[model samples]
Target: MLGSLLIANRGEIARRIIRTCRRLGIRTVAVYSEADAQAPFVREADQAVAIGPAPASESYLVGAKILEAALQSGAQAIHPGYGFLSENADFAEAVTAAGLIWVGPPPSSIRAMGLKDAAKKLMAEAGVPVTPGYMGDDQSEATLLAEAERIGFPVLIKAVAGGGGKGMRKVDAAKDFAAALTSCRREAKASFGDDHVLLETYATRPRHIEVQVFADSHGNAVHLYERDCSLQRRHQKVIEEAPAPGMTDEVREAVCQAAVRAALAVGYVGAGTIEFIADTTDGLKADRIWFMEMNTRLQVEHPVTEAITSQDLVEWQLRVASGEPLPLTQAEIPRRGHAIEARLYAENPHTGFLPSIGRLDHFRTPSDIRLDSAVEEGGVVTPFYDPMISKLIVHGPTRQAAAAKLAAACRAVEVYPVKTNAGFLARCLADPDFLSGAVDTGFIGERLASLLPPAEPSERVLQAAANEMVRRAGVPPALTGFRVNADPSFRVPLDHEGTRYTAQISPGAQPSALHVVVSGRDFIVFEDGEPYVLTLPRVEAGPEGSDGDGGVESSMPGLIIEVMVAVGDTVSKGAPLLVLEAMKMEHTLTAPFDGVVASLSVKKGDRVAEHVLLVKLDPSEVK
Candidate 1:
């Protein structure tokens, strides 16, 4: 085993690698950007080094600076955790050439699998079944359109480099193919710097299954079964689980053998993933599986693999890099239990899945399972990098237990200020269709409304909505001793999930009962220390507050992302003037009525507290 290793990444992945390193008695050196100076990973490492500035280009992606850190720290090897220079072939070569172990795959293998177009061609040549599409060198627009027409409609245009659904678009018709290609190319170039793309026949009801392959320098390789990451949004994985539900033994063996073959073909070393698109419409079969691109580095969902196999893949990587042969055979790796991982992102889920940013006033995730995250309660979710706040991972003896635990865990997680997809993940977990494992890439948008929380309030919410008035200029609990002689009721306007709630609070609106609403619905968060929240139908925001602020701002607590108009600019009735991306959805700040924008108090990218002044529109200047 290597004595010391420098981790060339930040956040949860870097911290994850450090954990395994410590278990194996490896001294670890952590490198961080300015933004991650006080990160958990830095504090956990044996030694920490400052690489560069905050931007990834200046920090994480700068291979030279990372290599310099390793050298200056006197580390024996470098571990490129998942992102950044993990897939950079040149970086691997430089690491070894600089007389340091790369602690990943051979540089040649990274080069072979770096580009999607190139990898697809190689996989096809290696007898691995590849998806039928245009993988040729023709970059001409007309040629791509012709290829799409040949492949039939509903083809996917994907970036040749990088994943994360960034530069991939599905074109259902020729009319949209060109535009999709242009947009994909721009995003690809901006994200991965490779505008080269490949087209594939988009399989209906496709399940993404990947094989974890490990190889050592001594020409030894083995397969670690498969993981199903079929439930996805924006082509990115949402929930991933091991021991795919209803997998046939014949197909499993074939996929594993094919993965081993693919690894051997590239002379792969260390841990790498061979992803395949499974057409479950005709049941799981070896013939129905098509090769997707191979990830050249450690995967984000590798923890699921570890939980099931009881093997530390990072330790294996270090051992392999040290010229150690395979410690165990293919049969040695055991699949013990089911593991599921949900990527918790700072995003809005209502209007559209837009990224959210801001300071996390309070973040409390479940302590029951393994959670991989770089952020804390006070961490800032910057727009400069990926908006993933954390990853909620759970494992159990059975798939049902795993799914149920994940659902319960999501509901219990409370992340304040910056919103997260905790509710969405819970809904996805509880979806009868999802629990049945009938999921694909378009699971979110296809069943958006059904999976989303209903836009209605519950009675318990009305009873506890007395505090909503206090938050918006109502009488405080300490001074609200005087009560009306009649019914003693007052309306507290509560807005959540784009709808308003008029809570009839007794004692003429006491300060204790605040409303927690979501999507035009109100829920009583049994602050009585209860587990579940009681919901109710929403009422209109009546004339309750002293201020003339008529606009229903943020219904729930979240961060505002984009302010679209200046003061006195808007004139339309419902034109979106500002965008509030909360919990992975975009809620537009629109005109309350047909009027002109009057008083705007917030700017773009400003983190506004819930119910803060977003935009005040004059309800008069209408026709």
Candidate 2:
């Protein structure tokens, strides 16, 4: 085995790799960007190296800098965890040429599956069941339109080298084809440096199922069963599970065999995943499955596979990279119980899932389950990388039990200051269709309303906040605001997400408890249970010409990527004014009302903090 290894990534995955290396007695070196200097992974490493600045393009994605760090740290191997340069074929080759063990598949295999168009052709030749798509080399718009016509309506336009929902569009009609194609190509070029796309028949109800396959230099490959990743939003997976629900014996055998064949065909080494889109229009069956794509590195959802198999996949990757054969034969690898994993992200579900960045004032996870995370209570989430905070995995004897446990776990999560998808994930787990296993890729969209319920703060939560505020103010009980009928009563108003709620508090049965009602919802409150709610003093509306009348402030801290307006441009409400890039995504700032731009304070390529004024508008009075 390699004596020392360098992790060419950051966040939880880097920490995850470091943990395994420590278990195997391998000294691990961690590389970090300026934004990640204080990251948990960097502190946990045996040695650390600073690559470059915060931006991925300048740091994590810079193959030369990462290689330099690895060599300088005396790391004998480089493990490119999941993102950034993990799937870059040239990086893998360069690592090998530098006399360092690359803890990943061969560069040839990565190249073989790098582009969707080429990989589809290869999969077809390898006897794997591939989706019927136009993978031809013709780049003409006319040819693409013709191919879409031939494939039928509702075809998918997917970028040849894109993943994670980038550069993908679904066209529902012929009239929308051209505009969709143009937009897709623009995004594809921006994301992958390739405007190439392929047309494929869109599955009516698809379940994303992938088989984990690992191979060794000895040409031995074995499948580690499958994971069902049907729950998704915007083509990004939200939840995943092992041993796909309702999977039959025959279907499992066929899919597992096909995944092994695909790995062997590429002469693959180390860990990889063969993703298939199974048409569940009827139900999961062998013939209904078709090849989607092959992730040429360890997957983010590998924990579900590990939970069921009781095998450390990272250890397997190291063993294979060290020239060891398959740890277990095809028959020897056993699948046990059911496992589910939910990706916790620093995003607000109410505002179109906008990425949230701030300090995690109180971050806690259930002690019973497995949590792979890099954040602490006082940690800060910046706008430099993916906003994923942690992954919560649970295992139970059956699928229902696992689902129940996971739902409870989601509710038990306590994240403060920065918003998270914990409540949203809990709603998904408790969804009726989800519980019945009748899920598809479109489940979240179809049930978005129920999933993101109205934020009606409970009476208890409001009273707790009011009580805390009173205690903090050192206000005497007899001095409660405008006492009624010789009794102490207080009305506390709190602002959350731009909405205000009034909490009516009075003395209750005990000194610690309080009788509280929030927005007419009644309940009793004590000091324990549910997390403390942040209470902000209500802001009284000022005159129309007062401060902040027309000031447009940034919702989050980010870099200004594009500015679309000038100092004197007249604009209507909701006109796109600028674009801010934050947490690896773009958010468009728009005009709040009909106004003329009186002053512009920012320009393209400028970094702004949250609540920073970007533009001031001179508003026109309305009738």
What overall lDDT, based on C-alpha atoms, would model 2 receive against the true structure? 0.83
Model 2: runs farther than 4 Å from truth? Answer: 467-500, 509-623
What is the Cα-based lDDT of residue 64 in candidate 1? Answer: 86
Candidate 1: global Cα-lDDT?
A: 0.77
lDDT of 1 by residue, 206-276 (tens): 88999999999888999888999988876788889888888888889999899999999999989999999
Error of 1 at 359 (Å): 2.0
Q: Tens-digit lDDT track for model 2 on 394-488?
A: 99999999999999888878776678888889889998899999999999999998888456666666656566555544445444422235335
User: lDDT of model 2 at residue 56?
Assistant: 98
Cα lDDT listed for each candidate: 0.77, 0.83
Off by over 4 Å in 1: 453-623
TM-score of each: 0.78, 0.81
